[model samples]
Target: MSKKLTKNKKKYRDKISHNKKYSLEKAIEIIKKTNFVKFNASVDIAICLGIDPRLPDQMVRGSIKLPNGIGKNTIVLALVDQERELEAKESGADYVGLDYIEKIKSGWTDNIDVIVATPSVMNKLSILGKILGPKGLMPNPKMDTVSTDIKKSIEEFKYGKVFFKSDRYGIIHSSVGRISFSNQHLLENIKEFMRKIIQSKPSSSKGSYIKNVCLSSTMGSGSVSLDIKNFD
Candidate 1:
C-alpha cells in the first residue's frame, strides 16, 4: 500500500480500536464521523453469518420498508401493460414500458436503482436475465418487486424499500440510512433490519448464525464492530 493510504487508515484506526465492540448508538455515531466525502454518504451495515450458503435451505433473502427512507435517490424501472403504465409513472417509476424491454434487449440498462414488473410481463423477461440477474435488478415476488399492483410496488420502492440477500460468504450487506438522518432514526432502522435478518435465519445451519456485525460509511472511514445482542 502507498504511504498516504496507510496514513489514512492509521487515522481511522486511531479513533477506533479493532477489538472494541460498540453499542448500536455509539456505532451509528462513529459511522457519521467516517464520512470524508463532500456528498451526504450512505450509512451501511454488514452482517457476517455462520452458515453453509451452498445449501439449498440456507439462503437468506428479504425486503423491508425502512422506518426512515434511505436518503439517496431511488430510481425504479417498471415493466407492465398499457393500463398500468400510467399508474407506474404516476407512482414515480423512472422508466416504464415495452420499449424498456427493447432497450434492455439491446443492452441499455443504466442509471436504474430498482426494477418492478407485473406478473403478466415476467414471462417476457427470460432474455434479459443475464443482463439484470447479476445486478440484482431482476424482479422477484418474494422481494415484493414483482406484483400486479404496480402503483404500490413503485411507491414502496420510491420511498426506500430495501431488498437484501446474503452472498456466498454468508454476509448480508445493505445500506440502512443516510448520514443526514437523525441518530434515533438510524438506530430504529438498524434494529428493524436486524430483526428481519434474524427472522430469516435458515434452520438447517444449527450453529451461531450471526457471527459478526459492523457499521461503516460508504467512503470508508470508521468501521466499527457492533455487538449483535445490542440490536437484538
Candidate 2:
C-alpha cells in the first residue's frame, strides 16, 4: 500500500518533475526553494556509481575537504594518551583522552561527530569495535581518524574534512551544505565532491563510473536528478 503524502509534501511534489534531470545550479535552486521545513535543511547529494560494491576491487571511497564547508559544526572526540590530550584539545577536539574509551565501553557515545585516535591508543580501542564499528565512529587508519599526528587529524576533522564510503547499493550520499548556502557555494561543493569521487574511481570499474547524481533537501518530497555530463 502506498503511504499518503502530507499536504506540505504534496505541495513539494507538485513542484518537481520526476523525469527531468536538472543542472547543478538549477537543482540547488529548486532544493532551496521547495524546502518547506521550518528549520534549515541540509542539502544532500547522492552519487550513484557503476561499481559492484561487493567486489572490493571496484569500491570507490575517500575523504575531501569541501571548498565551502558543510554548514554543520563537527564535534570531535580524540582518543589519545595523556601527553597528546592537550594537543588534541588545542586543535579543537571536543572530547579528549582514553577515559572516553571507558565511557564508550559504558555506552557513553554521545555528542561526538568524529573520533580521532593515536596509534598508541588504538590497541585499547580495539575492544570497542563492536560498539563503534556499526556507528561509523570507530577510528580507522584509512580515514585518517587514526594517526600519529593527533593535532593535525583533529584539526582537519574539526574544520571540514569528511569521509565517504560506498554503501552496498554503490551510492555515495553526503551533505554538501545547507539550504541557506548560496547557490555558488553549493554548486562548488557538489562539483568538488564529484571530482573527489572521480579521483577515487577504482581501476577495475568499467564504463560510465557515475550512473547518476541527485540532490535533495532534508524534507524535500523527492530528489532532483542532475545532468551527470556537467561534472565531466
Candidate 3:
C-alpha cells in the first residue's frame, strides 16, 4: 500500500477496517461508498465453501432469481421450434430459433449470456457440444435451460435468474447488482443470493458450509470481507 493514495481511496481506507468482518447491510453500504468508478459498477460477491471440489457428491450448483433484478440485462438465446419462435421472442429472448445453430456452428457466440433450448432441439445442438460445452453455453435440464417451456425459461433468465457453480477452488462468484442501485435493493439481492447458496449445500458436505464471504464492485476500492454469521 502506497501513501500516495487518491482522495477517494484514502476516504474509503479511513472508513473501512480491512481486517474487520462487516455485517451484510454494513458491507453493502461500504461497497457503495468505496466505489470510485466513472461507470455504474456491478456489485460482486464471492463465497468460499468448505466442501472439497474434488468430490463429485460435494459439488454445489444451482440457479436463483434475485428478489430485485440484477441491474444488467441477461442476454438470452432461445433455441425452439419454428412455430415457437414468436413465443420465445415475446418472452424476451435476445436471439431465437434453430436457425442460430448454423450461426453458432460458425463460431459466432458473441454477446450472448444464457442459452435456453427446447428438448426437441437439443439433439441438433448435441453436434455443437464441442463448441458450446467449453464455454458453458450448452443448455442443461439442471439449470432449467433445457425445458419444454422455452418461453418460461427465457423469461426467467431475461429478468434475473442466474446460475452459480463452485469453482475448482470451492468459491462461488456472482454479481448481485450495480453500484447505482439502492443499497437496500443490493442488500436484498445479496441476501437472496446467499439464501440460494445455503439452500444448495450438498448433503455430503460436512463442517462449516460457508467459510467466508466477500463483497466488491466491478472497479475501484477492491473487496470487503463480510461476517458469515450474518448470513446464517
Candidate 4:
C-alpha cells in the first residue's frame, strides 16, 4: 500500500510538471506568432504603463466586467456610515461596517482582498497612512473606494474594479482574467485595458509614457511580451 501511494504521488507530480512545461512552450509560441499590430491573443495579459504622479487625480478608477472574471475569490469589506450600513449588507459584501477601519488597524482584517467605504470613513482612516497604504489596500478617492452609493459600489467591485499601482520595479500588476478564460475573450479584455492606460497618459509627460508590457499566467514561468507602441 505504501509503495502504491508513493507511485500515485509521483504520477500526480509528473503530470503537473508536464502540464506546466507545455503551457510555457505554448505561451512562447503564441507570443512569437502574434505580431505587434495583430498580436491579439485569446489570453489576457498584464499591462504596465507610465504615468505622472503629479496629476494623481487623472488616474482612471472604475468597474469593468472582465469577459473572463478574475479566478481568485475576493473578500470585500464595506465601510459606511450608520445609514448605509444595511444597504452594504444587502449588496453581498463579505463584511460590512463603519468601524472596519479600526478593525483593520487592530490586525483583524485578514483574508480581505477589496475594501469599499464612504468618504467620511476614508478621511478618518487616512491617519493609518502607513499601514494599509503599503499593502495597496488603501481606500483612496481615485479608486472609488470612498462613496455613498453602496449598491453601485458593491456591484462594480464584484465584477472587476481592480485597483492598480506601480511596484518598486515600475510595474503595475493586477489580475486581468483567469487561466480558464478563452484566449479571444482574454485578448479583448487586455486590449480594452491597454486602451484605457494609453488614453490616461498625462499631458505633462512629454516622452513615451508606455514603456513596455508583458503577460504571464500566475505562478507560471516566463512572460510573453506585448508591444504598446500602437496599442489602440
RMSD of 2: 2.9
TM-score against native, each model: 0.93, 0.93, 0.94, 0.72
Q: Judge candidate 1 at residue 34 and give its lDDT.
A: 61
For every candidate in turn, the CA RMSD to the true structure comes to: 2.3, 2.9, 2.3, 8.2
Q: Candidate 3, residues 1-232: lDDT per residue as tens digits? A: 2443376787787777779999988888888888777788888999999999999888888788888888788999998999999999899999888889999999999899999998888889988899998888899898889999887888889888888889999999998888999988988899889998999889989899999999998865778999988887
> Candidate 2's error at 204, in angstroms?
1.2
The whole-model C-alpha lDDT of candidate 1 against the native structure comes to 0.87
Alpha-carbon lDDT of model 4? 0.61
Cα lDDT, all candidates: 0.87, 0.86, 0.88, 0.61
Q: In model 2, which runs have C-alpha deviations exceeding 4 angstroms?
A: 1-8
TM-score of 3: 0.94
Best by TM-score: 3
| Local accuracy of candidate 4 as per-residue lDDT tens digits, 1-232 | 6566456445433434322323333443443333222213223455445655546543434444455556556688888778888888888788988676677778776887778787777667776678777676777666777776878878777776566555444456666765555656566666666666666565655676777676665333335655454363
Kindly indicate the candidate among 2 and 4 with the higher TM-score: 2
lDDT tens digits by residue: candidate 2, 1-232: 1243367677777888879989888888888777777777899988999999999888776678888888888999988889878888899889888888888999998888899888888889889999999998998887888898888887777768888999999999898888888899888888899999999999989888989899999967789999988887
Would you list the clashing residue pairs of candidate 2?
none
Ranking by TM-score: 3, 1, 2, 4
Candidate 1 all-Cα RMSD: 2.3
